[model samples]
Target: MIEFEFVKPSTVADAVKALAADGAQALSGGQTLTPTMKQRLATPSVLVSLNGIAEMKGVTVGGGVVTIGGATTHATVAKEASAYPALARLAGGIGDPAVRNRGTIGGSIANNDPAACYPAGALASGAVIVTNKRSITADDFFKGMFATVLDEGEIITSVSFPVPLKAAYVKFDQPASRFALTGVFVAQYAGGVRVAVTGASNNGVFRWKEAEAALSANFSASAIAGLKVSPKDMISDLHGTAEYRAHLVKVLTGRAVSAA
Candidate 1:
């Protein structure tokens, strides 16, 4: 990696101010960014570390919503988010021990990797991402692969997920990286049902509306009987073909629903 000044601020405001400097980039777990930096794909002049900020670290669940601090590590979430077992289980399975200890939920969501698990859980759970500036819904925060709608110098403070009546996440993982080859999240609320799919589309995580409609009518694995996922918008990659990913989406959604 190139020479870069590292700043660890103790407060969110101070960190935000530090990040205001030109060519300054935020650093959390370093699981994703560090690798890219080593490859020389990213060359920030300064690195602002958020791990030192005490206010942005913890997890809380009450009043029907599970709130997790932006800097809270995956291991903490796995232990704390018991109110939403689906989300907690998802967190626990994110990566190996070291990654779980170091990776932060905010970092994962901010990066918005197409194969990442958080996006699908957030989208299906109808999470609200709180930032230094404002609160953004998961639907609006994610734009595309490695993209989000966050403004410059805006840091994620926490994420609040509405506890669902029933929800589950099932993923077909890519062996080497453990990133989802295809993942499905199914959530049933009193109002209706939400189904989100990830790691299968080039456009990134998207709602499986047809599956949602099917499950809304009848919430069961058999509800999705004869349901089809077209390969038109799915991703074609070295790990699997578009058709293969499409099939996994259907199968995984059914499994999630059954488990839920």
Candidate 2:
């Protein structure tokens, strides 16, 4: 690992200021960052630890929206299943207990891994990413593989998601890593329906417009009957072929709609 300085800020303002310094990177749960550092992929001059900021941790649901603090761990969400069952299910499905205890929503979304489940949930729920500067819609927050709209020194404070009338997530996990080979999140909101697919595409997270159209017409599993996703756009890895992952997208989407 590369040698680096560490700064633990007591507030978001302090963290942001510390991050504005040269070669600074925010450390939330360190689930992805730590590994990247260990592999010599990220060699920051300073690590701004957000754990010291009390404002960046917790979950709040009210007025038809759910706001999750940046530092809120998956274990907290899983343990408080009664608040949001679907969210609890999503959190519980993240990884083993150790990972769930440390990995955070902010870290996951900021990293925006192609196979991460939180992105799917955010997209499907029409979540807004609240950063130190401005709020970014999920559609604009995620750019591509391991890319996002976050600017240099910008910090994600929290994420606010509109509560869907009904929603559910389904994923086909790789047995060894528990990473989603293909996962789908289906949601029926007031304006319309949204279906976000993760793990199957090179684009990281994308909306299944065809499936959303079908579900909007009729919110039912059978509604996805004629929806066919082209494998041309999906990612092909050792876990599954592009065609296989595409098939799973439709299948899991149907299951999610049914479960919702």
In order, candidate lDDTs are: 0.93, 0.90
Best by TM-score: 1
Winning candidate number (lDDT): 1
Work out the TM-score per prediction. Answer: 0.98, 0.98
Q: Least lDDT summed over 10 consecutive residues: which range in candidate 2? A: 79-88
Q: What is the C-alpha RMSD of each candidate to the true structure, in Å?
A: 0.8, 1.0
lDDT of 1 by residue, 66-142 (tens): 99999999999999999999999999999788999999999999999999999999999889999999999988988
What does the lDDT read for residue 237 in candidate 1? 82
